[model samples]
Structures are given as C-alpha cells and as structure tokens.
Target: MLTSLAIRNVVLIEALDLEFGAGLSVLTGETGAGKSILLDSLGLALGARADSGLVRAGETQASVVAAFEPPAGNTRAAALLADNGIEMEPGEPLLIRRTLKADGGSRAFVNDQPCSAALLRDLGGMLVEIHGQHDDRGLLNPRGHRALLDAYGRCDAAAVASAHAAWRAAAATLADARATVDNAARDRDYLTHAVEELSKFAPEPGEEEILAAERATMQKGARLSDDLAAVSDCLTGSDGGLAQLRQAARRLDRIAGEDAALAAVLEALDRAVVEAGEAEDRLAEAAEALSFDPARLDAIETRLFDLRGLARKHQVAPDDLAALRDEMAAKLAAIEGGEEHLAALEKDVAVKADAYRAAAQTLSAERQLAAGRLDAAVAGELAPLKLDAARFRTVVAALDEGQWSAQGTDRVEFEISTNPGAPFAPLAKIASGGELSRFILALKVALAERGGADTLIFDEIDRGVGGAVADAIGERLSRLAESNQILVVTHSPQVAARGAGHLLIAKSSDGTVTRTGVHALDAAERREEIARMLSGAEITAEARAQAERLLERV
Candidate 1:
C-alpha cells in the first residue's frame, strides 16, 4: 500500500506531503483546482515521462518521493529488487524517488540507491497501476493480456516453459553435431593420408638431439683420424722412438757390470723404453675408437633432417608429433562412425519436440476453459455500471507456429460489443472513453481475487455516470479496496462519501503567485466537502442533509 507521497516544486503543487491509509481514499476539488496535478506528481514518482513544464514557474527542478509497504507474501517486487542488486528486508517500505530538471533530464532512485528509469518503471508497474481513459501500460495493452489471464486463472506455465527450453537445447545440440560431421566428411581424405604417414615414420621424443650429437662427434673424428695414424706409426715401427730407446737400453746394460756410471745410464734408458712402449699402445687404441663409417654418419644426418622437416610441416615441435598423430587417428575413427552418432542425435531431438508439443497443448486447453469463465464473470458486472447492453469477452486464439513461445502459443485479448447484436471488437477500437473505463472496472472486479499491484488509482472513472450508476461504481471500488489500496480522483458525491479518507485540493493566490494545496479532511470537513460537491459553488441546507445521508449510507 502507498504510505505517503511527497511532491515538491511540481507545477501548481509547490510543496505537499500526503499520508494515505488502507481502503478507499478520494481526492475531490472543483475543475482546474489541481486535482490532476496530484495524479501527475504520483505518476512522475512512478516513472512516468518527465516534462520540464511540470517544474514550478520559478523552481530549477521538481521531485517526488512515493513510499510503499508491500504485503508480506509479495515476492515479485522482492525478486525484482534482488535482480537489480538492491537489498530490502521483508515488511520494509519501498521508496521510489524521481527528479526532473528544467532541461528535461531526469534521475530515478529506489530506496535511496540510484537506478535506471526503465528499472524504476518496471518496479512501478509491479507496485501501482493507474487506470485512466488513455492508459496503455496496464490492462489496455494487448501484449500483457496473456499474463493477466494466467494470473486470473491461477494457471502455471512452468511445465510448458521447461519443455520448450529442453526442446530448443536438443535442437541446438543436433545442429552442432551435424556441422561437425559435415566438416569432417569434407576433410576425410586429408586425415586418412596424414595418419598413414605418421604411423609409418613413428618419430620418437628426443631422437633429434641424440642423432645431432652423434653426427657432430663423427665429423670431428673424421677430421682428426690422419693425425692419430701418423702418431701411431712414430711410436711402433723399427726406426720409431720405442725401438731406438730399447736398443740404447740394451747397450748400456751390457757395460753396466764394468762401471757404476754405466749402470745409472742403463737404468734411465730402461725407464724411457717402458714409457715409449705404453704411448704406442695408447695411440693404437685411440685410432680404433675414432674410426667411424661415413655411411653411418650419413644415415644419422638423414634421419635428423627428416624429423625436423615433418615437425615444421605439422606446425608442431618434434616432441609433440606423437600426440598429433594420435589425435588425427581419433578424428578418422569418428568420421567412419559418424552416421550412427547423427542418427542418435536426431532421435533425441524428435523426442524432446514431442514432449514440448504435448505440454503446450495442455496449457492451451486450460486457457480456453479459463477464457470462458472470465467472459461470464465480466458480463455479470456490466449491467450495474450502466453498460447493460454491452457484452464483454476474453478471446483465446491460437498463434502460428512461428509465434509460439513459452507462454503456450495462444493470443489472449479482451473484446467488447457496445450494443446488442453488434459484433465484438477489441476494447480500444469499440468503446468510447467512458465505456473503456467501465469495461476495465468490470474486469478488475471479476479478477480482484487473483491479485495485482497493492495500490490502484482510478482517475474520474465515474465521470459520465450518476445516480444508481455512480453508486454502483462506488460500490465496486469499495469492494476492490477490500484487497487493494484504492485512490479515486472523483467529483461524484456518492463516490466521495465511500472514501474512508478524503483529501481536498484547492488553489489559492496571494496577490502575486498562485499555488495548489491539499488538505486531509476530518469527519466534519469531509461532510462539508461532499456537500460542496453536491451543491457546486454554494453549500445549501438540503445539500448538507443529502451529504449526511450519503455518508450514513456507506
């Protein structure tokens, strides 16, 4: 329910704060006394289009703050708040504030947190619905008719939505699988050739590094082999160093028995012969170890070059060639078996589509039944509001397959026929301004138990009717207020008397500037106001008496 509305510098309303209560509240004043200003201010706070002209004559800006206390079990508003990343505790008030500048710019805030105007408008629709002759956002919009019907019928569309989602997902999966198989089929020859080539060569990790090192060593040994052979010949032949040293040692040993000096010389010659013989053996071993076949070296170099060339061709390092080969083999296998896989996917998609169709059909049947009941209930309410000759209907028609959605493939609209035997047409096309308001009222009363926004504002709904009709309109408004907070901008004394709370809007000028003010009426003040409504400019004794009776009747 709307707890209070604070408006500042908005047109004729300079500064006004109005507190509202439960049940029906009526605002009454003479024409041009700024009753519309109050509604305009409320609309501004509820995210209506902002106009610079709405700012007071000398003010730089205008602002409105509307506070609401959502019912305990209302989750729609809470969910919206959460989706916007705003937190609000249960039973807490939801405050919506809007400011309009003279430059035609505006800002919106919810609970003091800045938000977008679009978000504020959406939240406003969930909290308050203003029904006037020109209202297009609520009941009058054909787009929202389906949701309203579902709410009225208490029908759940979750199963249909879930089934549709599953079907679409399956179809998407099938599409992706088909694309993969088609692409693979186009590349089948390339995959087959690559896999065969890799299997034959069988490149191993680290093989390139080992072969390159061996090649380098063989090249160096080939360069040094001639020098090693020359050194071996000097050490081992008859005139070589080893042979000459042994001959000197034998001569010295034969004279060693005759002199001590000769014996020392023989010992030195023997050590020299032993060292030269060891050197010759070492040179022979080095020659054997350095001998490598040129053919072996050529084979190692060829293998290394082949491995590097293959790595470059596949755009991979030599070490990764093995893994790439395995991957190609797997793709070839999938291509060979793709037909069976494609068949499985097609069957799954068919099953999902069938489930979705069944769910949508069931929901459509329930909506058709709901449409009949709704038409009857609205028809029953028409006669009391002076629309006795009119007929109202809820049209439930199937949409084309291309237009099908999670909402169950049906288009729902409210239609009416203004005269007896006239073909029913859409509400907007057939009814006049006054008849449209009444038709909306009838629909509201019939669907009252279903639930809507906490607050409902009706602007001059009783404008064209009076006597029993006005009384009937008041009675229904009173009934609707039993579950909703109703604020009616009315001129009818009967409707004014039905209000549990009354506010009087009056315009005043003090020599220079004119301004509008709203006053909450007490019991005596309410009676005088209603009497003024009945007698026009002058209050008469009879009008007061009639006003007393009107008040008592409520």
Candidate 2:
C-alpha cells in the first residue's frame, strides 16, 4: 500500500505531503481542482515520463517522491529493490523519487540509490497499478488473461505447473533435433574436404620439421661446394704449383754437402708437398660429393610450399595439420551417426508435444466451464449498472493444427451485446465508455483476490455516471477492498460517501501562485464534502442529510 506521497515544484504543486491508509479511499474534488495534477505527480513518482513544462514557473526543477509499506519480508519486493541496488532499512518504508529539470533531463532514485527510469518503472509495476481512462488495462492484456482466468477460478497453480513441465519436455526434444540438423549442415562440406586433402598429403606429426632441417643441410652443402672447388683448384687443378716446389727441393738436396741449412730447407719443403697433395685429393672428393642436384632441390621446395599452403588454408601450423585431420574425421563420424539420432529426437518431440496437447486440452476444458460461470456473473452485474438487457460472454477460440504455443492453444476475449436481440461483439468494439467501466468493475470484483497485487487503484471510474449507478459502482469498489486496498478518484457524492476514508484534492492560492493540496476527511468533514459535491457550491441542510443517509445505507 502507498504510505505517503511528497511533491515539490511540480506544476501548481509547490510542496505537498500526503499519507494514505488502507481500504476504499476516495479522492473527490470539482473539475479543475488539481485532481489530475495530483494523480500526474503520483504517476511521475511511479516512473512515468517527466515533462519539463510540469515544473513550477519560478523553479528550475521538479521532484516527486512516493513511499510504500509492503508487508514485512515480501520476497518479490525485496528482490526487486535489491536488483535495483536500493537499500531497505529495517522497519522503514520503500522510497521512490523522481527529479526533472527544466532542460528535460530526468533522474530516478530508489531508496536514495540512483537508477534508470526503466528500472524504476519495472519496480513501480510491482508496487502499484494506477488504472484510469488512458492507463494500460491490466485485464485486457492477452498475455495475462489466461492466468487471470485461472486465478479467478482458483485453478492456476496446478495447471501452470503441468503446462510448464510439458513445455520443457517439448522444448528439450526440439532443441536436440535442431542441434543434430545444424551439426550435419555445418560439418558436411568440412568433412568431405578434410578427408580428401588429408588422404593425399598424409602428413606425419613431426615430418615437416625433419624435412625442413634436411633441406637446410642440403642448401648449406651446395654453398660449401663452391669453396671446396676453389681449394681443389689451388692445390691440384691449376698450373704446376706442387710440381714446381718439388723440383726446387730436389736441386737443394744435391747441394746439401756444401750447406747444412739448405738440406734442412729441402726436407721441410718435401713434407709440405706431401701434405698439400693429400689435402688436394680430399678437396676433390668433397667437391664431387657436394655437387648440386636441381631435381632434389625442386622436390624439397615443392613439398615445403605445399605444407605451408595447406597450413594457411586450415589456419594451423604445418605440424598441427595432422591433428586437424583427426578432428575432421571425428566430425564426419558424428554427422554420419546423426541421421539415426535425429530420427529418435523427432519421435521424442512428437511424444512430448502430444503430452502437452493433452494437458492443454484438459486445462482448456476447465477454463470453458469457469468462463461460463464468469460470464453469467458479469451479466448479472450489468443490470444494476443500468444495462439490464446487455449480454456478456467469454469467447475462447482454439488454435488450428501446427499453431501451438507455450501458453496453450486458446484465445480468450470478452464479448458483449448492449441490446436484447443484438449479436455479441468484442467488448472494446461494442461497449460504451460507461458500460466498459461497469464491466471492468464487475470483472475486477470477481477476480479481486486472484492474480493482482494487494493494492488496486481505479481513477474516476465513476465518470459519466450518477444516481443509483454511481452507488452500485461504490458498492462494488467497497467489496473489492475486502481483499485488496482500493483507491478511487471520483466526483460523485454517492461514491465519496461510501469510502472508508475520503481525501479532498483542493487548490490553494497565495495571490501569486496556486498549489494542489490533499486533506484526509473525518466523518463530519466527509459528510460536508459529499454535501458540497451533491449541491455544487451550495451546502443545503437537505443535501447534507441526503449525504449522511447515503453513507448509512451502503
């Protein structure tokens, strides 16, 4: 329930603080008494769009705050506040505030923690629902209609659980079959190409590295061959280099008896010739062994390029190609096996879908029975609201084959006929403004203790109504408050007298500006206000007596 509302610098409301109590509270005032402004301020605090023009003329900003006292340990409210990062003090009320600047900038706060407007709106929905001529009709929402019907019939909990289980089973089977199909589609070409490529190359895990090392060695050998040939030419292939040295040594040996130093030099030159001859033979052998082969080099280059190209194509290193091939093989095997698995999955989905259809059919039958009762009840309520000849019906249409959904296969809509011989039509299309309000009231009364929260506000539902019809609307609203807090904004004296509490939305002036104000009325004050509403600017004794009597009867 809303415990308090505060406003500052919002339009004519410069500053206002109002507290509310439970049961049927009515806010009554004449037209243009700032009643709509008060509701608008409350709506803004509940996260409605902010308009810069709503700020007071001399003020730069406008602010509105609403405080609520949900039941202790309300898990949904606690979770919602926590999700918004709002702190809740022990035994303290939940505060939601909105600030709007003249520049069109706006900010929202939940328990003093800054938040986005969308988050505040979501939280506001859980706390209060303000229904008016333009407000979103919670009852008309198709998404919630079925649950509402079940709630009204007290049959929701079991039906919802069974339906959810059926849905989960069906969803699981569908997911499995779809996964199989996707895998087959994705892996078909990949497997075929991988198998074909790997069959030809058949690369080993470390073969590329070994081949690369061998290619380097061969290349080095080719480079060394040139140096080896040059050395061989110096030693043996060119002019008589070694032969000339040997001839000189032989001459020296003949003169050895004349010079001892010449004999020593001859012996050293002979040893040098022997060593040089051996070195030349070794160099020639090396040159022959290291001779370049174009064919072998071409083969090595082709293999290396092929390996590198395949690596790039597959986005892997040359060494990882073997691993990639193995992975592709595994995927191909899975796809091949998928056909059988897909068939099994289809069977499973069919079974679960049939089960869901069966449960939905059962739930639909129950709803049909409950709908008959609800239609009869609503029709009975219409007569007292001055539509004695009107007809009410609950239309439930079945889905065709292949048009199934998670929410079941029925479309429920309210239909009405305003005359005795007229055909029933959809409520939104056929009913007048006054007729719709009465229908909404009856439906709400029937579902009072059902799916809705603990608080329900009906804004001026008494519009375009007076006399006995207004009294009837008041009676129903009072009855609704038995299970949920009911708030009604009205201009009817009959409706005002019926409330457990009455609030007057009045405008006060201080010569320069007019501000909206709210006052809780005591019994005597309520009587005088109802008299004022009845007589309109004149509070006669007879009007006061009528107001008092109207309160006594209802």
Candidate 3:
C-alpha cells in the first residue's frame, strides 16, 4: 500500500506531507484546488516524465516522495526493491523519491539509494497502479491481457512459451540448412571447376621450399662455372705441372743407383708426382659437381611460378592448396548427400512444430475458458457501477501463420457494448470516458488478487456521476480495498463519505503566493468537509446531518 506522499516546491505545493492507511481513502477538493497537482506529484515519484514547469515559481527544483508498505503475506514489492539493490529490513517500507531540476534534468532514489528512473518505474509498478483518463500503462494494453487471464485461470504460460521457443529454434535450424543447400546448388559449377583444376596437380606441402633451394644453387653454379673452368685449366691444361713432374721423376730414377743423394731425390719426386695427380683428380670432381644445368633451372622456375600463381588465385598458401582441394571435394560430396540431410532436418522440424501446436492449442483452449469466466466476473461488477445494460466480452482469436510468435497464436482483446442491442466493440473505441472508468474499475475488482501491485489510484473516476451511481462506485472501491489499497480523487460527496480515511485538498493565498495544502480530516473535520461537498460553498445544518448519516453508515 502507498503509506505516505511528500511534495516539495512542486507547482503550487510548497511543502506537503500526508500519511495514508489501508482500505479506500478519498481526496476531496473544489475545482482547481490543486487536486491534480497531488496526483502529478505522486506520478513524479512513480517515474513519470519530468517537466521544469512543475517547479514552484520561486524554486530551483521540485521533489516528490512516495512510501509503500507491502500488505501481509505479499513480497512482490520487497522482492522488486531487493532486485534493484535497494536494501530493506523485513517489513520495512519502500521509499521512492524523484527530484526534478529547473534545467530539465531529474534523479530518482529507492529507499534513499540512488537509482535510474527506469528502475524507479519498474519498482513502482510492483507497488502501485495509477489509472486515469489518458493513462495507457497497467491493465490497458492488450499485450498484458493474456497473461492476466492466464493468472486468473492459473494456466502455465511458461510451458507454452517454452514450447513456442523450441518450435522457433527447430524452424531456424532447418531454414539455415536449407539455405546452405540452396547456396551450394547455386555455386555448383564453380565448386566443380575448382575441384577439377586443383585435382590435376595438387601442390605438396614444403615442396616449394625444396624447389626454391635448388633454383638458388643452380643460379650460383652459373656464376661460378667460369671460375671452375679457369681452375681446370690451371690443374690439367697444356702448360700444367704434371708433364714437368713426370720428366723430373724419370731423370731422378736413372741416376738413383749412382749416389744415395740421387735415390733420395728420386723417391721425393715420385711422391710429389703421385700427390699432384691426386690433386688433379679432385679438381676434376669439383668441376663436374659445379657444372650448370640451364634446362633443369628452367623446369624448376616454371613449376615454382605455376605453384605461386595457383596459391594467389586460390587465396591460400602453397601448402594449403592440397587441403583446399580436399575440402571442395567434400562439399561436392555433401551435395550428393544433402537431400537426405535436409529430409532429416525437415522431419525434426515437423515433430517440433506438432509439439508446439499441441501446446499452443492447449493454451488457447485455456484462454477461452478463462476469458468466459472473466467476462462473467466483470459483468457481475458492471451493473453496480450503473452500466447494467452494458456487455463485456474477451475475444480470443487465432492469428495467421505469418503472425505467429513466441506468445502463441491467439490474439486477446477486451470488448464492450454500451447499449442493450448494440454489437460489442473494442473497449477503447466504444466506451465513453465515464463508462471506461467503470469498466476498468469492474475489471480491476475482478482481478484484484491476480496481478500484483498493492496500491491502486483512480483520478476522478466518478467525474460525471452522483447519488446512487457514485455510491455504487464507492462501494466497489471499498470492496476492492479489502484485497488492495485504493485512493480516489473525487468531487462526489457520497464517494467521499465512504472513505475509511479522508484528505481535503484546499488552496489558500497569502497575498504574494498561493499554495496547495492537503489535510487529513478528523471526525469533525470530515463532517464539515463532507457537508461542504454536499452543500457546495455553504455548509448548512441539513448538509451536516446528511454527512453525519453518511459517516454512521461507514
């Protein structure tokens, strides 16, 4: 329940603090006595859009505070507060404060802890619902009707949502596979061409490095070929030392027996000739090893160029060409096997779709049943608010396949008929302002304990009705407060008289400044206020007696 409201420097309200209690409370005031200002202040605390014009004439800022205390056995408000990181002791009140600066900026706080405006709005929703002529939040939206109906019927919406999601997942997976097959079919010629081209001479890994090294050696050999030829000329050409060495050896051998010195010289010359001959053999081997092969170099360069060109064309390293060829071959193979794969996916989708359809059908049936019961309950309430001839209905209809969603296939809309023989139409389009308020009140009374929010505020719902009609509205409001707290702003004295607690809205001026004030009426104050409400500007004795009788009834 909304325990209290405080406003500071907002519009004509300089400073106002009022505490509230359980059950139905009424705020009564004369026209333009700042009754709307009180609601605006409460709305500010509830995260309504801020405006600089709300600030008092001389004030730099305006602020509003609303305190909510959950009813016994209700934890939704506390849970919401805790989820927003606002700490509260067990049974502690949740305080929401909103401050607007004159410069078009605003800040919000929950339980004195700074928070975003969004958080305040969300937490506020769990605590209070403010219904008025132009309001679209709360129970007005068609989107929430299904959930509310489900809540009223105790149906498992989660189960239906889960099934819907599973169906979508299966459909998405199947669609992706089908798209892949479609794209592969479109690129079939390209894939086949690529496979054929790569298969002819799939480049081997590391073969490029080996070929490159050989090419470098062949180039170096070409540079050294002339040097090698010069070396061969020095070692065994016409002017070489082999002939001289042989001649010296033979001369030494002939005089070897004449003296020991000649024999030693002959042995030395023979060893030198043998060593020189070995050197000549080694030079010949080196020349043959360094011999250049232009044809072999040309073949190697051609192979390397082809490999590099293929790598660039295919956007892969030479080493990866082999792997790419294998992958393309596999994709082509999958094209052959794709029909079977797609058939299996379609089967899975069918099974999932059937399962989802079953769940949705079950949910739809439940909604139909709940809707009937809801119509009856709300219908029972309408006559008391003086719409006895009105008809209320909940329409549940299936959407087209194109309109299918995770929320299932049914569209839920609230409809009403204002006359006995008229066809029912959309509530928003058919009902007058006063009639809509009564309809909303009836719906709320029917679903009082279904959706949460411990507090409900009606902004002059009894705007154009009085006497028995106003009395009926008061009775229903009082009945609704049995399960939820209710606050009504009214000019109806009958509605005011039915309040368990009363607050009077009055505007006073002190020459320079005018301010709005709210006062909690005591027993005597209540009598005078109710009489004023009944007798207008003059509170006559008959009006006072009537006010006493109204209080006695309470």
Candidate 2: segments with Cα more than 4 A from true spot: 71-92, 157-330, 400-403, 421-426, 430-432
TM-score of 1: 0.79
Q: Clashing residue pairs, candidate 2?
A: none
For residues 1-554, could you state the per-residue lDDT of candidate 2 as single tens digits?
A: 88888999988888889888888899988788888888888888878888888888989999999988843545666787776567777888888889999988999998788998988777776677677776654665555677777766655446545665766776686686667567756878967887789868987788788878768867877889768766666666336567667777788778877888877888898998898788777776767666657788778878988988988998998989888888778667657776787677677667776777777788788889888888877877887777788888887789785665655777777778889899988666666565666777777876665766566777788888899898888888888888777888888887887788888988878897787878899889988999898888989999999988988887
Q: lDDT per residue, candidate 1, 1-554, as tens digits? A: 89999999999888999999999999999899998899889888888889899999989999999998853556787788889987777667888999999999999999899999889888888888898878876777788889888988877899999998998899898898788778878889998998899889898888878888888888878999989878877877897878888887887787799998888888888888888878887877777777778999999888889889999999999888888899888777768887898899899999988998899889988898888989999989999999999998889898998888878889999888999899988888887676777888899999884647888899899988889999999999999999988999998999999999999999999989999999999999999999999998899999999999999999
Reference-based TM-score of each model: 0.79, 0.71, 0.71
Q: Please estimate how well model 2 matches the true structure, expressed as its whole-model Cα lDDT.
A: 0.79
- The list of candidate 1 runs beyond 4 A from truth reads 70-73, 89-92, 197-331, 449-451
Instruction: Name the best candidate (by lDDT).
Output: 1
lDDT over C-alpha atoms for residue 204 of model 2: 75
Candidate 1 residue 326 C-alpha distance from true site, Å: 5.7
Please report, as a residue range, the 10-residue window in candidate 1 with the lowest summed lDDT. Answer: 70-79
